[model samples]
Target: MTNTDVGITDDEGSTMTLGEGRTPLIPSTHDENLYYKHEGLNPSGSFKDRGTALTVSKALEEGIEKLHVCSSGNAALSLAVYTRRAGLECVCHVPEQTSESKKQLMEALGATLVEYDGVYEDIFHELREKDLDGWNVTPGVSNTSLEAYERIAAEILAQVVPEQVIVPCGNGTNLAGIWRGFEKHGESPAMVGVQMKGAAPIKKALEEEKSHAVVEDPGESLAEGIIASESFNCAEATDAITASDGRLEVITETELEAGLRELVREGILPEPTSAAVKPVADRYDGVTVAVVTGSGLKNYTELRELC
Candidate 1:
């Protein structure tokens, strides 16, 4: 994949090489013409590491002593690891329904985990309303994550020039980053955003041609991190999709399950969030790149059973 060395490194003099970034843009065995960006290889076992590291670092740079964030799973884990490294206190409000392993990882990294009863977005709103005592609140989907995704896009462009790029949509930060990264470099790749069927606000917005916040249902899926019903950047997401000549594709539970299974068969274990990108890959018939956003290890048992 096309990449910039400067974007991937965690600043200079940092020797923490979890071998993050520069992941393979592999040609699928099933279809030689297709490519996959195996982002599951990132440190902290998810693509969110890219953004979390940068966000945490920037927060530290700004002299923020403590941090708080609301997440479904992946982002919390990413922040936990990064904040621990940066010697910053972290308090994460996560959905009560998030995975056990994810919760364990958060605590293991020394983050104070507060489980909330309502939706993920509700927790974000709650955090926003409360007095954090000057704790740097990591916006659930910050622009810094886009910088991380930019590194991903840069690498993809370098490795193999693709006609299309697909990513799982949650807060739409990943899509926004990829769109902006390529655009900054004077490149335009057809960008497809995927969401779980009934949970897809981005797809709905595109279909309706207007963007609005959505309230998520109580039930949960394996793609816990992307269980967002409301997008902080709904209009921007809509604009990116329209501008890219791309569309949002929402996959049903059955379709998502199948997609998860396919990744395992190929020796890639994708978490629920990453599984959303699969159908988009299947739909497009070209040198398409689908970002496998997180490790199957996050949902290892579930994936193994399904496989």
Candidate 2:
């Protein structure tokens, strides 16, 4: 199925796409009841394309000629591709340490790049300092992107209505969006959010029963996609998790490494962070679908070293 079969349509009644949606839902190689929604197959090699396609389409229709975004890697790359396709200028500010593979491709897609010395929050802070305002296409911050992300759940329902959906949670928009999507269809599934140990502020906050808190000493992992030092959408994320009767998990470096090996053996090479759900999904009862957020190709070099 094409993205148009399952995505938001424009005012012209056509979904602007670069083959961004209708990703295949593949059965797992090991667990019979578990499946993988391989979003890495998206044009930008991450689920971020789903958001970019819709948001950029809406922006283009509104005569938006330029876009601004702050991303870890995948989001910037996806924005770069969509904006270029729309013939709009894109400026992306990303951490200096982003994977070279992702950064190089963003530039090749005609996005002007400004590298910063820290993580997403730091870069975003500096962007705020510049007093520059335009269309911000970051994945978790806007309504259109959330609407686009809801399509993932819609497609999953069409493919297989599992008892639960597992997602790698950074800011929790994808999890929340999917829950909302299922709600729009009048169905709800158990939502599960997983994060790498060091970067899981959401998990920590939930565990502590607090509204918002930062990890005092964050650790490093190759799963940079889901590694937000602190979450910006904590309330939205927690609300979704709470409303859906979903639970949170924090996986270790050992678990991330082992999960990567297990998933690779199962014929899925997810980025290290996206594999955070494998161990949990392996033990969950009933049908479960794990959303593999991005491809290992986004950081093949670092992943190979980790493996």
Q: RMSD of model 1, in Å?
A: 2.6
TM-score, every prediction: 0.91, 0.91
Per residue, candidate 2 scores C-alpha lDDT tens digits across 78-123 of 8888888889889988989888898899898889999988778777
In model 2, the number of clashes is 0
Overall local distance difference test of candidate 1: 0.76
Tell me which residue pairs clash in candidate 2.
none
Q: lDDT of all the models against the reference?
A: 0.76, 0.80
In candidate 1, stretches whose alpha carbon ends up further than 4 angstroms from where it belongs are 1-19, 136-141, 215-218
Candidate 2 CA-lDDT value:
0.80
Report the C-alpha lDDT of model 1 over 24-142, residue by residue, as the tens digit.
77778798767889888888888877777666666766788788888888878888888788788888888788888889989999999999887878787777778786464454435
